[model samples]
Target: MEERYALLLERLTKTEPEFQKAYRDSLDMSWIYHDSALEGSVYTAQELKAAMDPTAPIVTDSSIQPICEEIRRHREALEYIRDFADKKRQPLNIDVVKKIYLILHPEEGDIKTVKYRKDIPQHRLYFHEYAPPDKITYKVRQVLDWVNDPETRRTRSTIRIAARAHYDLLRVFPFASDSGKVARLFMNLLLLRGGYPPAIVHSTERQRYYEALKGSSATMTQIVHESIENNLGSVEKLLEGHESKGYAVKV
Candidate 1:
């Protein structure tokens, strides 16, 4: 699994620089959301893929700066976290998220939200409908501890580790509005750096996706394993008929 992931990363890195730039730009644009401006509007996976076309219409340089900065910070933090994991020989760290939050929202203080209830256990199950009474800042330290814990550092397989890291963090719900966005970015960063192809669970998949995560406390291991297996299978299929031609960029 590790070998395959490494090979894919090498291939991705070696892709034409112009294509890489375009692909990265596409990723950045797809993540931005706005209710008013075209540049700010929410993008579905299909729209995002269509927008990736080098020939497709797009907002100009002036419109893309803010979103680009956020993407840059995300990728930069991802690189840092990947390096830290390799050097420290540990599971993903929560400090990485803190660093990312600061980079993405430097002026912002704690993310405001309702507080968690006293009746709920700190490590207990997630309540989707009930909003926690506290803001995101309150959970930062706890998130850090959860990731850096020695018991969570197991590495029998890269896929398993990466997938579980993603699922567990999603369940943890460390951020207010950005949990899904952060998880997707963080997971792809790990996959790309740790030698796997980037995977995005589209909004279209939200229902099954949440269902898959619903029993997370008891089903995390199984869910992670299944997700990894499925992702790896897709990679294998992509390799079977892969061509550099399809991904070429005009810019």
Candidate 2:
């Protein structure tokens, strides 16, 4: 599996600039849609295109305005993480995680004042267990420490580390809302830093995802591995199509 992933990355480097942009654009839309869907927020295909595509016609429906804004914020948060992954040399920290949360909810206030859920309401339903309010801070710090530890990075596979980080954060459920999404974003950030593509755990796998969370990070790691493999296959097909069109293959 690792060999296949490495070969796929090598092939991807030979893709044309236009194809690369189109592929990334498509992946970004799918990434946003599936991630939101996993949390039970469904956006229609038309709505997603309208929000994500600058060339698409402007949306004027009053009812859809909030949806569009939410999509925009999520995209901004995605872009922020991508940039951070590319340029930032420092290890992942609490502040960076808080910044991601703040980007997703600017209305919530500044990063300095970012706060976790004081208490989860008993009336509310959640798909997985979360740390109690009193344990949120300590659990979050532990996750950061584990991910940032030099020995952890040196010994563990990137996928395993990323999956464990995601599971740990979701278990902590630091924020009252969007904690799942933030956990995913952080996971992808780690993957990108390790030269792997983002693992877009599709909404189709929602039940499997929840169940994995209920168990251990090992299950989550397998899900991530499969997600990466799926993405690599998708890109491989795209490259094949490009080659069939009489483009000179570099690889």
lDDT of 1: 0.50
- TM-scores of the candidates in the order shown: 0.55, 0.92
The TM-score leader among the candidates is 2
Tell me the tens digit of each residue's lDDT in model 2 across 10-67: 7767877777788778888889999999989999988888888899888999888889
| Top candidate (lDDT) | 2
Q: How close is each model in CA RMSD to the real structure?
A: 7.6, 2.0
Residue 39 displacement (Å), model 2? 0.4
Give, for candidate 2, the lowest lDDT window spanning 10 residues. 121-130
Over 4 Å off, model 2 = 1-14, 123-125, 248-251
Each model's lDDT comes to: 0.50, 0.87
Q: Residues 120-140, candidate 1, lDDT per residue (tens digit)? A: 245423334322446334554
Candidate 2's TM-score reads 0.92
Each candidate's number of clashing pairs is 9, 0
